[model samples]
Target: MVRGEDRHPSLSLHLRARQTAEYRASTAEAERQLRDNDPDARPHRLQHCRGLRESGCNRVLGIINLENFERENAYGESELRLLTTIAASLGTALENARLFDETQHLLKETEQRNAELAIINSVQAALAAELNIQGIYDAVGDKIREIFKNRDMGIRVYDPKTDLIHYAYTYENGKRLSLESEPLGNAGFAAHVLRTRETLVINENMTQAMTKYGSYALPGTQVEKSSVLVPMVAGEQARGIISLSDMEREHAFGDSDVRLLQTLANSMSVALENARLFDETQRLLKETEQRNAELAIINSVQAALAAELNIQGIYDAVGDKIREIFKNRDIGIRVCDPKTGLIHYPYTYENGKRLSLESQPLGQTGFTAHVLRTREALVINENMEQEVAKLGATLVPGSQMERSLIYVPLVAGDQARGLIGLMDMEREHAFSDSDVRLLQTLANSMSVAL
Candidate 1:
């Protein structure tokens, strides 16, 4: 029975033994073929495999292993052909997958770039719509916070005239903070940016970065972990700086953040400059209007004085025109009688009511005598009572006390004919140099008329 079993080995056991023998023979033959072609063939580790190559290029993508054959001639042309087909299919599939992944990555990057551009366009539109500097600052601040997801930011305007950096806008942790203007010395991050006219991105160790740039933390400010500062450059000069900071996280800002903030700073610089030009234009326009108005008043005064035939009529006309020009009703005209040596009040109005005064000796001491003596215009904007007292003068009886005064000597061809005085009881320094010039022009016409 044992001999019979050895010869036909229980069918399953015989089949396994025969399969092992065939596999060994097939592996040996394959290894021998490889060795015959190449001396470096490691026959012990040989396996049935195929190269997964890319189409056309014939680039080997990878290797694919098939199950070892269990019989001689089992891995023949048909099996080799099948393995090659599988390898080709797998190579194409892997290439398609890689291409699809690359496409997806590129799509995501494009979408991110588009989003950033949209935000920048929105910010530009917001800034363009504003003509006020404060409005521009608010829009910029709000947009920066929205994009960065942080609330700490500031905009500083550099004033070349004063050599100072003014904090136009500042917010920290969602709270608005007021900061005073400081000298633009060489010791701050803003100063560094202004000096270099470049952007700065510090993602960690802000203090160390500042130190590297020869800068220091401002006395009342908290140091942040990360910061991006951009110069608001216009033409060749840096107009200001825009700074954004993160308090909790290092590396909060990156290259993209720096680029975006720099773009924003450029837009802000243009908007601010436009606002300034608009303000300057409006101011000049207002001054022109005021000058035109004053010229009109002076022409009317000249016409009125030219028609007056007598000295008193000229005085009355002068008083009326002075009231119209100054909007103040308290006015007086003191005429020096050259032959009589007396100063006479030809026309005087107090609080819009006419007043009569007796003639007095033209002494060397009072304000009236001083005007006639010096033949020059005098302005007293404060301490009128003390000033007049210093000039050896006293207020007329029943006269309202005045706080502001302008006295112009009426000179006719180098001779002081008289004086015209305008007073404002309510305010000191209420008159401008333009006012004095206008009054002097009127006095010249009065002197000619007299």
Candidate 2:
């Protein structure tokens, strides 16, 4: 221990004997207490020794027992730097082992989460690419199955017009299929979400609940236990539900599952909207193509017919075209001799170019005169009461028809030439904006052809 002594003087036989004795004593005491199940959480304490020496003929370091478990051990002024260095190395190694174990667990958890998120992203991508509404539903169902690694899944859609939630899709036994729409009430889970715009979950005995929304009470399936019902809310509207069910697992639907489902549901809302818009665009495109084909035919017919043709022939050709365009059950065209003040001609058809009733006189009626004066299309929607007031009966003199009428006057440069008319004989279907625009398209083109 003197200054300038050999750095690691070899331990003599006598010094080795003393150091070995101390090590055995500490080791025996530590083992005895641990065997007795002693809760001695403290680290082992080493005893101090003197008269120590390095073993001979060996590259060995000095061994000295220091006092004080903490205060004297830390390297500072008046410190044995080598002993302090040894303690520091051993302390760091132990801490490093604990830190490494902790990091391993964290990495494992993160990897699992990443894998699940990857599955979710793939599902969202598939849903977004769907151009048909049904396709999106199917993709969502399949994604749910894949994420649960081919487990079961289901979905519901809420329709505001019908005020009902309908089962739209389900995944069972690793396969997904469209769930035929089954009406569900506006109360319970549906109402809770609708009122609060919040999510709904029922994680109890799903099979025991005897309702349409209940799990596996599906009229075709056996009882299933725990289930989760998630609301697919979008655009201030409750679009659908994603219900999960299993025959086992009481803790299947927990807060964690609900939160994950919510995040997925938000993505689902976006996917649903994208799919709906893509579908609508495709439908509009197809209709546009059809309209263009019809216009091609009309242009050909227009070129063949002349400007000097009598009003009656123009009425016949235009009526035919209007029937093609509107596809109404009944359509009529009438011409009035303005100078003669008498009925000139009338042409009518019922459904797809069928030879309707015989040609009738315009009868110089005031209804014709009124429309001729206005030169504006008048549409009356389901006017049985109005007809009773005008025609003095529950119906008109027509063969057999109900519903409504659209009266349009042919006005070319302030000259009221004639009129084109229609009556949806049976279907009480209200006309939409597109329907009105289509009718106007036919009316405008008919005026030019006439």
* Top TM-score model: 1
Candidate 2: deviation at residue 37, Å? Answer: 25
Q: Clash pairs of candidate 2?
A: 10-54, 10-55, 11-54, 11-55, 11-56, 12-54, 12-55, 156-240, 156-241
Consecutive 10-residue window with the lowest summed lDDT within model 1: 8-17
* Residues 1-450, model 1: lDDT tens digits: 011222221110111112233333333454454447555522222335565555665555655544322323335688778877887887787778878999997885675566456545654565567435566666667666676676588888898889999887887667788888889987678888898998888898777887787776566677788888899888888989989888788998777667667766776676667666675686687567556545655565566657744656656665776677667558888888899998888888877788898888887787778888899898888887788779988666667778888889989887898898887778898677767776777677556655
lDDT of 2 by residue, 218-272 (tens): 5555455666666777677767777676655565667766766676777677667
Regions of candidate 1 where Cα sits further than 4 Å from its true position: 1-130, 267-276, 290-450
As for model 2, its CA RMSD to the true structure in angstroms is 16.9
- Residue 368's lDDT within candidate 1 is 78
The CA lDDT of each predicted structure is 0.70, 0.57
